[model samples]
Target: MSKKETKIYKNVWKPGTEDAAKKFGFIRPEDIIRKNVQKKPTSKIDQILTGWGNYVKSHFVELSPELKAESQKRLEICDPCNMRDRGTCSTGRQGAHVVTGKLMKGCGCRLAAKALSPGSVCPLGKW
Candidate 1:
């Protein structure tokens, strides 16, 4: 994909930002047109269920300043990720009603809270 494709995420991009295109290569059509293809949301109900299970496995894992710091480190990466949307992953693959495989929305978790919790992990391993 091109910088042009970032627009789908509401980012502003110039077609021929000479310096940036030169640096990123993919931004230049001459380099790669099919670059940066959006990935398939691969998390299945089993994964979401697994994520939730981790949440339970780590039960009683209380919050500490360190955990907050750890979660922040993860969220920082998430903020700029392509699949991130409204604090959820685009690959909430099983859909919103995913527990039953009946929706097309983002990952249902409130990322800030969940990422901070020991009970959860990013389905995409981004964090």
Candidate 2:
């Protein structure tokens, strides 16, 4: 066969039977044998929280205990208010708030702010 014809035939007849097996939950003995391999357990929530914490830490400075407490209070108050008024702060307009420029501006998280602020006793780092 000509190269072009052969290429076309190969493309059209490419093997996709494994995909059908996957759809039907049919596993080859080799695959079953491989299943005995040890695998680490993954933590979905830990992964997500770790990613979020890292992102927050990268942006802000570490915080102090007092500041952390205040931020936590602010977050607690902000949560209900946000839920009532669409996921934002009510007073400062700085925490996912939609009204002011300061919206989404503050750490608003006790642990996060504590970890991101400069001179913070939080043990994380400066913002």
Candidate 3:
């Protein structure tokens, strides 16, 4: 009896995925594939509470000029980050600070409020 060999397929992209990705202006077809990569789930309740707390602290409370400056610096770093989608840190996205190469996780917080809050820390450790 001979042992059978199993063929393993790699880089198996789904049908029409590349086309749809192109239609949406994705620069690389691989970017679409990367989005489907599974990541460990972050706590939604924790994210929600943290976001709310930061929002309240940043908005209702007074911040020093130093804190405001710090927020500006953080925003500058976040502006070009791949994990930042719209205004929020995109949860479960991979990659890191584009320049620094540190590993990243999405905290699911609004960047503006999160930066302004004195106690808030970045999921990517940018700040």
Name the best candidate (by TM-score).
Answer: 3
How far off is residue 57 in model 1, in Å? 19
TM-score, one value per model: 0.38, 0.22, 0.47
Residues forming the 10-long window of minimal summed lDDT in candidate 2? 118-127
Answer with 2 or 3, whichever has the higher lDDT: 3
Per residue, candidate 2 scores C-alpha lDDT tens digits across 1-127 of 5687566544443346555554544544576466556544535444446535643755585645675555555445445443223432123343433433233533333433332232332111112
* Each model's lDDT: 0.56, 0.42, 0.67
Checking candidate 1 for backbone clashes, the offending pairs are: 1-35, 1-36, 55-119
Candidate 3 overall Cα lDDT vs. reference?
Answer: 0.67
The candidate scoring highest on lDDT is 3
lDDT of 3 by residue, 50-102 (tens): 55675677677875678778878999998998889999888869766546787
RMSD of each: 15.4, 17.5, 18.4
| lDDT head-to-head 1 vs 3, winner | 3
The lowest-lDDT stretch of 10 consecutive residues in candidate 1 is 94-103
Writing each residue's lDDT as its tens digit, candidate 1 over 1-127 gives 5455655323323454545645644245543444445434445554456545545655666546776677778889778765677887765443233244444544567566566555455555544
